[model samples]
Target: MTRAEGRPLRADAQRNRDKILSAAVRVFAEDGLSAHLERIAKEAGVGSGTLYRNFPTREVLIEAAYRNELAKLCDAAPQLLESMPPKQALRAWMGHFIDYATAKLGMAEALRALVESGVDPYVRSKEMMLDALASLLEAGAQAGTIRADISATDMFAALTGIALASGKPEQREQAERLLDLTLDGLRTSPR
Candidate 1:
C-alpha cells in the first residue's frame, strides 16, 4: 500500500502498518478514544516509533482504523461473489456487514472525537457501501435468485436497521435471524 504522501511502503513497512491498523481497531473499540498508544504498539508487535511514523496523531489512527474496516467490508463483495453463488455471496456479505457495523459501533466514541476535530472519517462511506451493495444486487438479479426491483439504497437502509437493532456481540444470533429474514424477503420467490 502507498503512504499518505503517495510513496509506496516497503514490504515490512506495509506489514507493520497493517498490524498497527488491526491493533488500533481492536484497542480503540475496547478502550475508547483515550486508549494508550503504547498499548496499541505492543498489541501490534511494533515499536512506538513505528506507530507514530505510520499515524502521527490519535485522530489519524482512529480514522485509519475505521476506514480500514470499511474498505474490508466493501471489498468483500467481489471476493464473496467469486467464491460462491450470488445469493449465497450476498448472504455471507451480510454477516461481514454486521461485523463491520459492530466494529463501527464499538469505535463510536473514537469516531465522534475524530469527527469533532473537523475531519470526516465517513467521507465517501455511503457511496462506497452503496456501490458494493449494488454490485451484489445486480449479480443476484442476473442469477434470478433475488428480486429485480430492489434498490441498493433501500437494501442499505434495511441492513443499517438490522445492524442498529441487533449488532452487538451478544445479539449475534438475533442479527443472523434478522438477516435471514431480510434475505428471504429479497428472494425472487419468498421462502
Candidate 2:
C-alpha cells in the first residue's frame, strides 16, 4: 500500500476500498447507522481490522458512503454524454438524480444524526451537483438542443424541488412527469 506523493492506489488496495464502500452503502441503506461494522466487513469479504483501518468510526463510514454515491452520480455525466445525445444525457442524469435523492431520503435519519454530531457530511455536495449539471447543460447548449438562458443552478433548484415534492413512493410517477415538464421548458423553441 505504498505510494509516491499523489500516485494512485495499487489495484488490490483499490479493489478492497471499493468493496468496503459498496458494502457500507448496502449496510447503511438496509440498517441505517445501527448497521454493524463487522457485518459490513464480512459482506465486503474483508476482515474487521481492514474495515477499521479504512473507516475508524460509524460516522466516517456513513460519510464515505454518501460521498461515494455522489461521486458515482457525478462521474456518470461523461459516460452519459458519450453514449447519447446531449439532451438525452441530461434527461438520463435527471433520472439518476431522482435515485440519488431517494437514497438520501432513505438515509435521512442517520444523516441528520451525523450532522447533529458536528460533522458536515455534505461538504462540497452542492458544488459537485452543480458541476455535474453544468456539464450536461453545456453539452446541450453546444448542440443547440437546449436554451442557453437557463443556468445550471436553475436546473439544480428545479430538480431539488421535484425531488422534495415527489419524494414519496406514491408520487414517483408524478415526479417523473414534472421532470419531463421541466426538461421541456429547457428545450430550444422552434423557429
Candidate 3:
C-alpha cells in the first residue's frame, strides 16, 4: 500500500497500530530503550514485520508511546470531572500527573533519543495540561471551593516542580506532603 501523508488508517491497520503502541509502552516501561521491538511485536500478538510496518524505528515507537501516555493523561480531565467534585477531581488528576511523571522518567532514555533526533515531545504538553487544569479549577472556583486568584499556568509549574522533586523514590513521602501543602494553598479560606 502507498504511504499517504496524514491519511487515516484502515480499520484493521488502526487496530494493529493501537496494539503495537500499547505493547511498546509496557515493554519500554519495563525495559527502557533496550527493550526489543521483536518482543513488543510478540506481546502485541503481531509479527515483527507488522511492528516495523507500524513503527519504522525505535525512536518512532518511543515517541508514539510517550504521546499515547500524554493522551491518556489529557483525556482523564473530563472523566475525573464526571466522577468527582471539581476540587476532588483536580486533586485526583494531580495524582495521576504524578504517576505520569514517574512513568515518563522510566522512559527517559527513549525520550532523550527523540530530543536528540530534533523532536520536541514537550512542545504542547504544558498548554494542554494547563487547559485541562484550568477547566477543573474554573469549575471549582464557580462552586466556591477553590480560590479564584490562582492561574492554571502557575498551578502547572508548581505541579511540575513537585513532580521533579518527588521523582526519586527516597523523596516520595516529602513530595506527597508538599503536594498537600500546595493544594491547601489553592483551597478557599473560610471567611
Candidate 4:
C-alpha cells in the first residue's frame, strides 16, 4: 500500500483507522481492557480484520487511543488561550485535566499491565503536559493575570493533586471549588 517509502495512508484506510481509534477510546473508557476487539470493530463499523490490520494487538490499540486522547488535550491549551483570556484558558485546561484524570483512573489497570510489558505509554506524558502548562502560564504571567514566580514543577504538582482529588464522582463539586481556589492562588493580586 506504500506509494513511496513514507507515503500517507490511502483515504479509506485512514478513515477506518480513525474510526477504530475513536471506538477504542469510548469502549475502553466504558469497559476497560476487557472490551473485545470484535465489539470495537462493530462500534467502528469496520471488520475485525481491518481493526487487526490497523492495530495488531489490544495493547497497541489502547496505547494509540490513549496517546490520541492525550494529544487532543495537550493540543487544546494554545487554542483555548488564543480564543480566551489566559486565566480562563488555564482554568478550562484544568477541567480538561480532570477529565483526563478520570479516564486515566478508568484505564489504570490496563495501563499498569502495559507498563509491566516494558512499554511505557506515559514516558512523554509529563513532558508534554509540562510544556502545555508552561505555555499557558507564560502567557498568563506576561498578561499579569497569573504570578510569574510559580515554577512549572510546582504548578504541575498542584494541578495533578487537584485533578486526582476532584476527578471522583462524589467530589466533583469540591473539585471545582478547589480548582477555583488554585487558580486564584496563581493570580497576581493588585499591589
Clash count (model 2, backbone only): 0
Query: 1-191, model 4: which lDDT tens digit per residue?
Result: 23236898899998888889888877877787688889999999999999998899999988887787788779999999989999899999988887777777767777777888888999899899989999999999999999999877898899789877777656778888988889989989953
The pairs that clash in candidate 3 are: none
Instruction: Mark the 10 consecutive residues where model 4 has the least summed lDDT.
Output: 1-10
Which ranges in model 4 have alpha carbons more than 4 Å from their true place? 1-5, 10-15, 169-171
Ranking by TM-score: 1, 4, 2, 3
Models 1 onward score TM values of 0.96, 0.85, 0.82, 0.87
Could you give me the TM-score of model 2 versus the true structure?
0.85
Q: In candidate 1, where is summed lDDT lowest over 10 consecutive residues?
A: 182-191
Question: Tens-digit lDDT track for model 3 on 70-152?
Answer: 87788899999999999888888888788778778878888987898998888898788888889989988998889999999
Best by lDDT: 1
lDDT of 1 at 22: 92
168 in model 2: Cα distance from truth in Å?
Answer: 5.4
Question: Which candidate has the highest TM-score of all?
Answer: 1
- What are the Cα lDDT values of the candidates? 0.94, 0.87, 0.84, 0.85
Clash totals for all candidate models? 0, 0, 0, 0
Clashes of 3: 0
